[model samples]
Target: MIAKVMRGQDTLGLLRYLYGPGRANEHTDPHLVAAWRALGVPDPGRDPDADLSVLARRLDRFVRPEVRRHVWHCAVRVAPTDRPLTDTEWDHVARKIAAAGGVAPLGDDRGCRWVALRHDGAESHHIHLLATLARQDDTNPDIHNDALRLRDACRALEDALGLRPTSASNNTSAPSPTRGETEKAHRQGLDRPSRAVLERLARRAAVASRTEQEFLDAVRSTGALVRLRETGQGGPAAGYALALPGDTAPDGGPVWFSGTALAPDLSLPRVRDRFAGAPAAPAPLPAAGPWGQAATAVGELSEHWDGAGQGVRAAGAAALGDVLTAAAVAAPSHVRQVLQGADRDWSHAGRPPVGTARAAVAVRMREAARALSAAAPKGQAPVGELAVRQALQALAGAAEQVTAWYRSCSWEPQERSARLAAEALRAAVGGDGAQPTLNFTM
Candidate 1:
């Protein structure tokens, strides 16, 4: 549940807008009002534009009348772009709500709410609950806090209605009235890794090109453990799996990080495994300062790296050049895709529309071709189809590097930065004195 509180200027109107579509429970149904009246919940529909802060006080009015009613207001959302709730799923949310101490079946009309509403032209569904409190008045207020309470409520409702794992996190910080546990269990919450910290580590894993040993070393640097379980049980350690460092503090000791090669076994595969079951990834850490940008760029290019001009071709060079150039910038990945698509179209039809970025690259390739041709005797310039094709490929690659350097003006993400320093150091040593000698002084 990604919880965010937006400050709407009109509380009543916002509440109405959120809950009062043609499919709204309070609109087409009569018993919903009766249920609220019977339960002692406030008449939220009365003043459509009332300030909610003031209404919070008036909530006591509802608590005054209905003996069965208690306050429970939370927003449960779904990424409807994916799957709709199946028949089995409906049963799950209901069961979960019941387990979390919610009584009574949330009527059929209410269940239909899941299929309702469009938010910002995207299909979105939300659950607006009006239910009585299952716990007595003596329940701790900390248990009522939004962070812990809403998650617990969501998990319980989801499990009851078959919405298990609909979300990624099962945040258990709230005091479960059902658990009957206390301070020690609550203290366990500290061991949980925050999304921010996990994201930072994941991003590192995403770009890192380390081998298994180096990869495990980096995970340990982040204070995690890797342990492998055999046959998914403690019968024997099948392999190593990484766990949050302090998670074992309660039971005994920390575990080792046995790197599991999931993807291409590149740096990023390690990061991907950490967030395997999560719905959305955490935000990337802000590239620190200027040096941080260089470091991050280097990190992205590390391992098996050669000069940017090499034949393998660089990823994101189009995008990279756009950022550092005097020319109008466009997204490199998008530009590259569009050009290839356009080329395919041209092959099938006529010349396709090529954007500025593609046009520039094409021009550079042509120039490189002319230079290579001139270097050869005019008519004798490589004329074989195979020779011509290789020459063209090399020409285009040379143009990519030359122009990228022209665009960046100074630093490049790859080996150029180190080479530049080496060049200056060599120059300082005079024309023939670049090499160091054992007897030389600084």
Candidate 2:
């Protein structure tokens, strides 16, 4: 579900386009679902024969008393689903629009006016809403952050309606375009105003590129200025920021957006995952050792995990335990015993404790959880995969929390132990045979 809010004046022109005949809504005759009239005005109550123009004109009067941009317009486009929406579902969506857009007053007799129209068009079915910002009492509902508010509303609706997921809709970090920015872009005839076009291009490049350098190059090719962010004590680039060279400020400084700020999918972490499992260039295979065996075992588990979905709920813990035991068989006797014990602890409580042996246990547990997640298969039964992924994530999160505790402890030996344990675990997990990071790629 995508909800776009555009605030402007000229309520009647929008009404004609929505209620009147046009290519965008020509096929959507009898489209008006519900109309909320200002208090003292007559209620239409889902009346198909209601004069939209008259209602619109009447609605406009309340806003006319206010000098601000009094017209509030929004379009809610639901992606195509396997099942068509019933009339009740359409009505529910209209309710969602009202509630989300603030057209529905907080109290009775607020006199706010609004109308919802369901449009079935060639491309997709959607709802168009036009509302008077000012209520019958000559006051306005707070619509200052309306675009972001509507986006959040759509996210809630997706979960409520069991609709398909969208990354941008789910993203909370991205700053949404304000009504003024949207209106300005429309006036200039820009297909996507503000950072939208740049965001789209960056996502495409991130998906197509094979390495960090390659991704940066691809973004640059689109005429975007790229800035790589370094991490690991200046070891390598770990993140990025991109900006359009053409979009600049008064002092000639280019406007920048972190990859994540543009869109969630274009975020550094997700984009890096796109090229996982396959490196930018050929690399040497890992040695045939215990870590290698563990990697191979995880890879096998990935293949079987999908088929086990039907029985996972009842048997998942036991199955993961079995896989963990098998994977650790080739390790040194002490390491194998540690791995087995960790798996048992995880199975029983889903988390291990931070104690004297916190370093040894937490590091291994974190790596194991990461390995399992990286090795999980993709491309089928997304809901099941998500369930499994959540389980793996819990294990990883628990370990990180425990590790943090160990680091903050008073004892010097414990902290040193943790650092050593972490280094050792990283070596074991980072070997070419595991390529743990690569496993998370789509």
Candidate 3:
């Protein structure tokens, strides 16, 4: 799940849009799954004017009297899962929001007037929220660090509901990308440049290099410029920054980022640890079936993604075949694990089927394969679309089986793992330009 937050004025205008009939001339309608006032007595289901009047009255109590900027709007979107959440599940989500946002339920300090609406658009499920920032005592609730708090809350819910934890839930060190930084990249003729490429190269270099000079050289070889910051008066270097030569900020200034800025794992201390004889990156488990082959194929596919040739279109297509072959090899082991119960991870509750694990691996592998197959070799046709669909269907079947087995075990690690696998599969099969959403899963 992903949550987006926006703060603004004009509470009534936004409220009208949220509660009014669907968008201009659109026939589709959004379901008002949940709606309630935190401290007020007005039912939000009343006429639009009444609803807005109540919402505005509450928001006007905030320290800032600017009605236009008195509201906070947010939306949470979840990827498709085995089945839609039940009413009971949705109620839990509402309660979670209240608790996470630091709103008092029944007290002198009860805060926020909010409602949640769910939409089943092309994207499976997403909920919209429009809320006042003022508290019952005509004061603002301290929402500082609310985003971080909400993320933690969502992770807790992910565990409770057996939903796959998202990247935000697992983030502990790296700061999220900001609007300015993203816009800068856009101005540089880049479309969501892959930070993974940078981190992967840095990691490989750190593992391969013995000295700082070698490390710098290794990074430079990857087309990234390394700028080392030193202490005053020629003292030992204090830190380093990296920048892409061809990519610059909108103002024509080079945009440099630190290791931690790229990813926490790439921080200098972490990289140096690998150089200081710390254990290398974790290897795939023994039962990871075709993982070895898939990894190799992924490496080649990455080359295509990184602009390996003028005709990358062709290289991408050929890469897909290699990716599929890797998935085909890895699928069986996952299936085998499900058929015969085994302890895959200590966190898992009951012994989950191998098929669950297989589905996860298979989906990720297929996504990589599909990405690489963007451009088939000169005269070589890629795998048939029917074959790809069939393989995906089989993986989905295994996932459904796992889900059914754990319908009543939301808190179980096995269920979480199954959800994670399904999510990974969904991401993998998500069509052209599809790249796996990198996240640290339980």
After TM-score superposition, the amount by which residue 79's alpha carbon in candidate 1 deviates from its true location, in angstroms, is: 13
Reference-based lDDT, each prediction: 0.30, 0.50, 0.48
C-alpha lDDT of residue 212 in model 1: 39
Candidate 1 C-alpha lDDT tens digits along 198-258: 3334323332312334445665676755453556654533444555545444459753223
| CA-only RMSD, every prediction | 22.4, 15.1, 14.0
Q: TM-score of every model?
A: 0.25, 0.43, 0.45
**Between candidates 2 and 3, which one is better according to TM-score?**
3
Tens digits of per-residue lDDT, candidate 2, 96-162, equal 6666667664344575677777766333467777787877777667666667777777766765665
Residue 343 of candidate 2: its Cα lDDT? Answer: 40
Segments of candidate 2 deviating more than 4 angstroms: 21-27, 37-52, 64-68, 80-84, 167-442
Output the TM-score of candidate 3: 0.45
Better of 1 and 2 by lDDT: 2
Pairs in clash, predicted candidate 2? 277-438
- Cα lDDT over the full model 3: 0.48
Task: Return the lDDT, model 1, position 255.
Answer: 30
How does model 1 score by TM-score? Answer: 0.25
